[model samples]
Target: MDFDPRLTPARSDLAARRLQARVTAERFVDGTPARVVVGLAPLRRGPRGDARLDTEALAGESLTVYDEDEEGWGWVQLDRDGYVGYLPTHAYMKGDVARPTHRVTALRTFVYPALSIKEPPLDWLTLGARIAGIAERVVDGRAYVITASGGVVVADHLAPLDRVEADPVVVAERFLGTPYLWGGRSSLGIDCSGLVQTALEACGVAAPRDTDLQEAALGTPVDLDPAQWRRGDLLFWPGHVGLVRDATTFLHANAHVMAVSIEPIAAGLARIAAAGAPLRSVRRVERPQ
Candidate 1:
């Protein structure tokens, strides 16, 4: 079988560079698809009696772009989490447009301009709102974000973007007290790697999803003691990740705490070291200014 596009050389240095350039803050409007097509309403199918999109496309596919009529009604291909199918253009909006843009956290903010104020994922906040104040990796890809106001939103969810170097520990600290959520990747609720990824993104750095993907993306491992570590240094063990806040402390989201929190890095390492887990690996990702 072919390699996963995310795993292959599809995202080259040139592409990575371009991603760094074009990623702006934005949202997705019309081009969305059901995570699964449960069933179809008549309007979802073409009026001229075209085949239903759900009947044709499989899960995790992409759709084509279509033209809209003067009345603002048209057929467009809908891509949902990689699944592409046909849907009405009217269902989307420029105000709701979702494309990839590289930007930092604007505020300790919330998603706005939404259908509802409560826990909505498609809601968005003002662009360029706050200074995320962290360092991210230097690579490129679209990011789905959550606003502090408990709203979900995807900014430039499809475009690629790159981040330059910044400190991971400083980045992690910004999200301190952020609640933990499974499969979450934003300031609202985040996982360990999600915490890492978002922290890096805020600092204009890039990292992969999950601990394993992130570990591989770091290129190679480095061995060093706490005294030798710096702000952006990353710490990892089996099934967990933490960012060095300094020589003594680090930040992470843990099920144990069930939210983003800070702790003594040396103490954590001491626990692990005493348990004889041994250090799986360590790496320092720094972006050149």
Candidate 2:
């Protein structure tokens, strides 16, 4: 049987105990749960610093850790999307996770030591990172949410988890000008699928973390004609995906521009087709009910 390594929590020597019957391994153990404690932790393909980044573990999200290797890397799967990778043990807390009350809505925001904005920043969080608010305070006519971990960040930068945007395209527009980072999941830097995933996620849509998975699962197929494209319609090529801003324009984070940018659909398609990857499919996403 074939399995996707990105979603499989198994290896020849160690595998999730739940898969004992389906996979053969030298050992099998149920995974331990942990919560991300750092602003952002790189989820890597391997345990070394030079390994390729698979994605990111955002602060406050829980993960199932199968192994805490000797070198301080945790073989884990992110709870949000089941993406399997290796994260440094220092980035997460060992135990159960707290339910997050609020999610970061800003492109980025600083964590402060106290309620005062004058305090030197302790850390930073990007859009999609969640936190449990222990208290709320109004200081100097500004609102602040005191995190359960005691960090102070602007209240306006966060929204209750239930609050969602009206459109994913609007959310994607916010990322324009962000530097492109392969495997990046934050507004600080992002990739083609990362932008789409982040945008749709903001609008309360659960999304897969990669282009191939997203293209296959996100939305039902639609006619491939550009004229049929509408806001939030996804366009796919061999290894890339982008959102249709309108009938005329599209938005994507691509290596070509090395940043999130919008361009005419015909131009983007022409350039990509010229490079040998023609538009393969169009998928229209439905608005959340």
Candidate 3:
């Protein structure tokens, strides 16, 4: 049977011939678990810097290293989303994976060596990056969350591990004006499905990374009429998806505007129709009653 490389793990039978054969021959089964060390490690389609960027692994995210090529690229599967791709082997460090105690809620935050904001940041963390808090410190009346890795992050930028945002739309709207990047999953640059996935994940809702998988798995189908749509509804088109801002408006990260923007549902529909990618489906994620 045919398999989509994007959705299938490298250990599966449908993976590439070399990977399948390697797994079948018992050369490797479960790969080594590692943590991303850089700000944003590019996951590429091939074991080269010039290869197509499929996705990204944020700092502190867990991944399983399957194999490494001579070029120093490691084939891995992202633990959070199960996305398989190649990233430089040097970008990962195998060690005790700290249990995350909080998640970054800001578009981006800095990790400082001290509690003072004036101290130069040691690293930058994008939204959704998980952090393990080893201790809390107050320096000169400023509070900071100290991570197990000896990095300090602002307390206000992180939320407790169990805290889930009340509304996905509210979470999505915070990224308004973020620039569009085809495979980006951060507020610095994001795409249609990335925006949706980021928003839903903040609300403690799991989501797939790609539009087609999201369309197939997220939420349940609802009426296609814009009039029937409510806030937090998802509208899908070929290769795209958007969050319903309200009864008549939808928000999306679009290449047309090159940024996240809100547009009337009717106008968006007309524009997409003009491009021959008409509205395909409407899905509503049922909320707690």
Candidate 4:
């Protein structure tokens, strides 16, 4: 049996307690539950500073900590997308996972210590970041939400977690021009798969973290011919993914352009073919709009 290392919590020295029957490890223990308390924390491929980033854990996101080293790195699995990686131990609160009451629907917003926007910002939150709101306030005709921890966020930027967008493609369109980032899922920066995953999340879809995982987990496969494509279809290449904006175009956060851009599918096919990564598949996800 093959287990993907990216999602598997088993290392040579130890493994999760639940995986004891499936994996062989020197030790097995139930992992500790935690929640990201910081605005965003980098999840690295390794425990070192120079290690490649695998993804970013958003504020209030749930995680299970499998191992914590003296070096302050925690090996954990993100509960949202099942991504396993190393993150700074102090970036998360070691306790029960947070129960999110609101989700950031805007591309990004600032957090304040007071109800006034004039107050020095405490931090910033990106799209899809979740918060546990305990109260709401209105000042100067603007609404704000008071977090369970006393942080204030503009209510206009948030929505109840149950309030989802109507269209994933329309949600994707909102990220146009976002800077390209290899492992980022935030509006400040995003990668090919992160863009797709973030957009789908807004529509209440649970998408995996990376391209290959997303490809295998999302919608049914369909013909790759451009004419057969629809607005909500997903196009996958070897290490890339994009959403169909319409029949003639698709949108993606590409390293080629170094930003999110809509490109003509005909031009994209030729350019990608020239680069040796042709379109591999098109998947149609049937959902509201």
lDDT of each: 0.48, 0.91, 0.85, 0.91
lDDT of 2 by residue, 1-289 (tens): 5689999999999999988888888999998888998899999999999999989989988999999878999999998988999999999997755778999999999899998999999999999999989899998899999998889989999999999988998888989999999999887889998889889989988999999999999889989888777899999999899999987999999999899999999899999999999999999888688
Query: Which has the better lDDT: candidate 1, or candidate 3?
Result: 3
Tens digit of per-residue lDDT, candidate 3, span 1-289? 4556785655433233445543343344557789887777889998889898888888778988878778899888888788998989988887677878888898899999887898899889888888889999887777799998889999999999789888988888888999999888887888999899989988888888999999999888999877788899999999999999987789999998999999988899999989999999989887542
Stretches off by above 4 angstroms in model 4 are: none
Q: Which of candidates 1 and 3 reaches a greater TM-score?
A: 3
* Residue pairs that clash (backbone atoms under 3 angstroms), model 2: none
* Candidate 1 per-residue C-alpha lDDT over 35-154 given as tens digits, one digit per residue, 9 for 90 to 100: 211111112344244543222221112343433455534444334222122344433333322333334334233332342334443323322222111222222352344333223334
TM-score of each candidate structure, all chains considered together: 0.51, 0.98, 0.92, 0.97
What are the clashing pairs of model 4? none
TM-score of 3: 0.92
Q: How would you order the candidates by lDDT, starting with the best?
A: 2, 4, 3, 1
Best-matching candidate per TM-score: 2
User: What is candidate 4's lDDT per residue for 1-289, written digit by digit as tens?
Assistant: 5799999999989999999889989999899999998888999999998899999999989999999999999999999999999999988988765488999998889899999999999989998999999999899999999998889999999999989997888888888999999999888889999999989988988899888888998999989788888897999999999999987888999999899999999999899989999889888877654
Error of 3 at 23 (Å): 8.5
- Residue 186's lDDT within candidate 2 is 89
Which RMSD values do the candidates have, in order? Answer: 14.0, 0.9, 2.8, 1.2
Give the clashing pairs for model 3. Answer: none
